[model samples]
Target: MTTSKQALPPVVSTATWQKELAALRIREKAVTRELDSVAAQRRRLPMTEMPDYVLEGEDGPVRLAEIFGEHPQLIVYNHMWHDGAEWQCPGCTGFTTQFTRLLGLEKFGARFVIVTQGPIDQALAYKRRVGNAMAWYSTANSSFGSDVGAPPDAGFAVNVFLRDGDTVYRTWHTDGRGTEQLSHLFGLIDVLPYGRQEVWQESPEGWPQAPAYSKWATSQEIAAAYGEDK
Candidate 1:
């Protein structure tokens, strides 16, 4: 049986919504400009020779260079998967879902890879959830992650690299909002209350949201926390 959808309460689109759409477009252009600036700034990251490193993959131990595969730049995003945590971070997983495919990234002389400090299975499990099997690897106890600014306990962010001849350089990095800028769609839409018209995710009459709150809650916990009907 096809149950009819609930009708929303009568409402009028007034000044409230006017700035919303306009802000969205404004944000879209702003984000694009920000990205262009980021690209230009990326040219300044400290240079480093291809440092020796071991990354255990689905196959086994593989050196880092293999990811380049003739590409001049490498964009490795740390997915911030914690092994001992009760659950995976849905926010991070959700963001990765918006991440463009490697082919798209590779076309620009850049290849994106997700390196995690968590156990292989822990990280792999989350990746499988999003079906983002993009070139993933495990750093184990190596400082490669922290050295790049993502302390295991602190979580992960996007890090960009440039390969010039045999030398590799750390060019750019983004954390939180900066990382949110990684995906233009997420920046202009998800960050907004009404979101984009293309993806229909209308906010409830009043969706009370807390930007930063108590400890993060799991899906099940959230249901209980909101007194949502089972």
Candidate 2:
């Protein structure tokens, strides 16, 4: 339902193009409505247990509640760790970079965090590279990510969890950049077959299209480039 934009021939038919544009608009609205309904369902879903599990953190192990800090509703991005030794996901990094713009979501009483299979230190290091001030932690040895319906093995998704007093609730969640169609990284997923399964950025041409861990890479390159050591 999406077109790869290209310069049209000078003799392009205006009426035909107008019809195409109208179709695109209808498709866009349908997608938006569908996503909104999903968001609403997410917001209405019951919350997960609060004091249940503790994810790995920079200083040490920390409970889920501790990550909340001053806010009750927390946005957790289930980041994918590179396979085996290479320990970071490029697509996940793409979403993290959006944090600088998402700071405004704070006004809605929600905070963001990234939960990866990598350790806390490694997550923090990558977060630094992306220049995101958002909160991050690792599910390294915890089931926090899995139990929340976003298993670490599941690659990536944006999950919003809400906490009201001692009770907590689950809010919105999104798996595709089609929802984040506004982001450059997510927008680029259109060129791919899966359309950003690990939806991150709509990167410009020549940037690493898909990031994957390779046993072929040198330890230094992997560590610096994909958080291999972490």
Candidate 3:
């Protein structure tokens, strides 16, 4: 196979490289500090009480509080869905794949799971198809998805909740680019020279560019990689 010519940055002396990196480091550190401050403010934000909506679990109907299990904090990723479709949203499918192990969350008194607009069986089937290890549930029969800003047939979202005894309160909800902080893939891609290589980013001239998500794979493609068919 033929490889395309790659555009590269100009070579510089060691001293010049270190000087430029150090200058950029100052801005990086400032951004880091600003993010920390935002996180601190998020921790202080007030929460709203949530109803004990019944969602479909692998077994049967379960209350939202019951899904929390023994954890006092619950983080639900609202996975996007398409009714009667063979595949679901690739963005959500790929994003949720990043969370294979969640035992680390339990140490912080938190549990992480997925809620989808698709039926429970379809969601679980897709979960198996993608080899996702997180607990999957269905909000198809409830308004929980819309209530938390991830309506049916909509995009993905991350919703945080705190449990006080039998009652649950919504602490925070984020969608769109707000979910980027949780993506290890995005975090690593953003540090590369090309930096996601997407058209919308403000990158230096001569950098390679493609439309957003052009490099992304569909759920079917990901599943097929795992030797799962149907």
Q: Per-residue alpha-carbon lDDT of model 3 for 10-104, expressed as tens digits?
A: 88999999999999999999999999999999999999999989999999999999999999999999999989888888899888887877888
How well does model 2 score by local distance difference test?
0.64
Against the true structure, what is every candidate's RMSD? 7.6, 7.8, 2.2
After superposing candidate 1 on the true structure, give the runs of residues whose Cα lies further than 4 Å from its correct spot. Answer: 1-38, 44-46, 188-230
Q: Across residues 1-230, which tens digit of lDDT does each residue of candidate 1 receive?
A: 88645434345587867766688899789978997896787665566554766677777776676667699888888877666876556566555555545677667888878888887766666565455546678888566788887777677788877777656767777787677556765556566544442323445654433344222344344324332242
Per-model CA lDDT versus the true structure:
0.66, 0.64, 0.90
lDDT of 3 at 8: 82
Per-candidate TM equals 0.67, 0.63, 0.95
Residue pairs in collision within model 2: 42-171, 47-169, 184-202, 185-201, 185-202, 186-201, 186-202, 188-202
- Per-residue accuracy of model 2 over 1-230 as CA lDDT, tens digit each: 99846433335589987987799899989988998997687556764455456888777887777777778778787877763544355555655655565567778777777788777777777666545556678887887777655575565776777776655556566775443643565456454544443225454443343443221234344345434233
The parts of candidate 3 lying over 4 Å away from their true place are 1-4, 227-230
Model 2, residue 111: C-alpha shift (Å)? 0.5
